[model samples]
Target: MNKTRSPIVQALLAEISTFDEAAAYRRMLPAGCYTEPEFFAFEQAEVFSRTWICVGRVEQVAERGDCFSWEVAGEPILVTRGEDGEVHALSAICRHRGEIIPCPEKGRALRCPLHFWTYDMQGRLAGAPRMGDAAAIATLRETVRLTQLRVELWHGFIFVNLDPDAKPLGPSLAKLEPLWAGYEATGVIDVPPAMSDTPLPWNWKVQVENFTDAYHPEFVHHGTHDFAPSIMPGDGVRFTDMKPGDNAIVRSVPMKTPDGGMMKDGWGPDAAFPAIATLTPEQRSRVTFAMLPPGMTMMFAPGTIAYTLIRPAGVTATYAGSDRVTYGGWLLPRSTIDLPDFRDRCAAVREGGSKIWAQDVPVNVGMQAAKNSRYLPEGIYGSLETTLQQFNVWLLEAYKRADQATR
Candidate 1:
């Protein structure tokens, strides 16, 4: 590893003692760590129950009578398309005996497989088998509405909130209204199937921190991106001077000079990346990056608008549901771009990105392991690490809340 360090790195290292507060907080997250109880506590209460989680793509249950079953934060939930053509989210467990309603190959109604108890697509008890008389049926119906999970469809993704009292996803997302409104004006949005799962030995915060640390690219992905003469010009470099809320948006441009032998200059050799020219002035000002409260990233490139869907499986494991949308607005007729091709290409890029991430994952694991050691250094924070610090604060606060509730 390069021993040469930045003033920021030096300042943080010098103050390590100030940040190590395990009793009041927990272990400090080093460059990498394997365990974090703070992350686990948040997952149990807020992330698992209170927040609206993105479970799957909206198109999964597009047709009326269609349904999709998913497990989020250990809760079995199902989203179904009602005969009336509305989408509904409901607890997948049967109210009768806590039996799970199995998702059939294709169906609109939710039926409990164990006792043949059935609920409408809206989660109302529609029928009961052999249990009671007609007079008692009304009582059963009143008693057995499937617990509803707050679900909202945005762009082409479906987000569900375990907390009934939580702010609606729409108003919550109103902060990004400009991006969404612009996307709708541009064209119809399309979503493709996403393949993702949780990785072992890394906290969710660790993953987000890694994404923000663009400084590691050169050292971590050196073999794939740095050494590849076709992709890198010289000894490859990582971006410095990172700011919070800044996004490293990426896109492919049609070769200007017919594949000028894959320019090594990262992003572009000149200021004008051919692709940006294709966008409107408004699009030019758009920025893409990940937002907080435990979710995926938002991308607003010249012609595309989308957010990746992230669900933490455990304190240290995460799953991603990524998709995108492109529209022409009033200037151009609206049309949605098919994303299979885009996702496949991005997947390759993400694959390359993952190698770089692999280098940081160990750091999180190691930090967790060394946290209990008396010799372990205190953690440090910088402006760029504000997000990580904020996450830690949020997690610790959550533990405080959980403890208060218990007391």
Candidate 2:
């Protein structure tokens, strides 16, 4: 254990060390890992900072000079499309005095408001008003550049890492590659999600646990999720084998009918977006959900690939963007986009997502609140919760690796 870790974190890690995956039944993590501020801080530094984090889709910066601001592990970053036609992730803090630099308007240079220090699309210093002569300014331009973070594009999703030496992200996600081929063959376009202005009051883990848990849909989302039953007659929820070094914890549930998807009520046969003809018969019969921890979750449906971007604000505050959380975050084919009633379809999907989300809100609140209770049990997992167990294993691996690095 790292000596710098607080007593609470140390105790939590000590308990986590005793976890045995081979046991007949798996237990939930210590509540302190979810409720304590010290552990959250450690997680931010060790896991979020060191790992690959999905920021946005590559389509966001499709055109040269296009840029957007985002935060990763509490550090402000600017993702830009440079003149050279390469995507770049740069620190948004101005080098002169560390004021946050917002993305500039179209056809303009990024200018820090504090002193009007300007940087080109590539984050090279362009100007520093009234500070030096032309020669000195040229020297500053040559020397000053926004710190560049490592960026890797996987299936058009842009992932950034604060650790310069972090391993490549693609290999860790190899298991998800087979699922994408069908979606990519038809060519998908992203409708990026609008980040929620208000953070959800729960640990980020709780939000994901709620998402990955297959057992709850039957009880919690009774009316909304009946069509995609996790406890069906013969075929129900199926889980993917999570291997060592794998980053995704995935599960798929059979739809009541082939090609069924999200409708106004929720997951059903009358999908708002029409099914893609290219998907395999197997793909059309099931909906696959994959969680790329600490950052994103994806849903591979017959009609669309829905995704959610998670940004943790505090130990108990998480901001996310998805059809269920805010709006958009859909990957649809061009044919769907050209439909005259596309907006209506999108609204119906959001409505369905909202209904499902409404059911989740109260339970999430209860789960988060229980973390502080003395009565919080060492939870038991059922066979339906394989994804949750996989997630716990993933989290423990991350924590242990970070701890070992410090030692």
Candidate 3:
């Protein structure tokens, strides 16, 4: 096995070297991780393909007879729910002539329109017309089956892994189960998922970093951002940074609540939905964001819980709802409470989300353009940028693991 690392990969390793908590927080990840095509391809195979990649919610295909077709980076995928009450992901390419199946095709079986080959919901061959003799048909059926991905559902999120032997997704996110234990799993309905995709001229990781890093709000979102009290470094509010191998991050900030009390609190309870009943006093007092990498973030607060539907586009871009997905804004921020029966409240959520997302596009695309610039500078993460440092650490570790596996 080839154990040597590519210059690009080696550059990444050295850039994101593990540092002490008090160490200067240099932009640990290399700029090339976003700009170089080769590095992106490595991530595609090593990270996206092998890891438990979050695609979308099971609500996308809720009906028992429904199926959804997907294509990412030329790899055709099909997800369907069988009558047996199970969801499955399989290759959407026809085994006979390699034809792509149309997306979201319904019914019990996937019948390739071009050829008459039919496959059951579980992806087992059901029928193929006029294949000479019974022996030939049986042999083809015995050996041919759609490639199946390892899939698991966590808190209504559907994640699929190309690697057949990948670890269970639940255990990987063990640290998060308790933090979010307060949420009523049943009450959290799929509120008409708000999915948006826009082209970024920068690497997908930048979006991931900017989302949870509280430091950026001081400038990037300066005037337009009205919801959260804008905070800057040396403001006496220190965020907790994660050590290597940490899968999540949580930080509490001091804010004045609308109830006329000067206490650390969440986004104003009035503008937000009702708090999850089970949240403890501290949990309700502040906002928390948890991540399931290489790019999934879950934000928890008294009133709302948000997540991204990210999919990677390439070296310097992303297509949310699909490869590796996100600016945190339009990335599906749902209320912790169920949507009220009233349409106005739901409309408010939709309208507010649209406005915020509009403000994010220029910032993201500009960052993308800057990443490919004459002055590629390393950023120093302040105490407030702990989330960024933690995420970057996770990114580096994932790359190292992927590299080691290749070796």
Per-residue error for 109 in candidate 3, Å, reads 1.2
| Candidate 2 runs further than 4 Å off | 23-25
lDDT of 3 by residue, 1-407 (tens): 23465677666655554443333346655567778887787778777776777666788779886777654433678877866788888888888898875543565478787887888777777788997688888888888887777778887777888888777777667667766666654255554333445655567687676666676654654443433543624433446546544555555453334211111121333543555556667666555556567656666656555666556777876655311132222222245333564345434444444455555667777777776787877775566777676666666667667756766
lDDT per residue as tens, model 2, 226-315: 999888888899998988888898999999999889998999898998989888999999999999997899999999999999999999
Judging by lDDT, tell me the better candidate of 2 and 3. Answer: 2
Q: Which residue segments of model 1 deviate by more than 4 Å?
A: 1-42, 218-287, 303-306, 321-375, 400-406
Top lDDT: which candidate number? 2
When 1 and 3 are scored with TM-score, the better candidate is 3
Point out the higher-scoring one by TM-score: 2 or 3: 2
The TM-scores of all predictions, comma-separated, are 0.67, 0.97, 0.81
> What clash pairs does model 2 have?
none
RMSD of each: 9.8, 1.4, 4.9
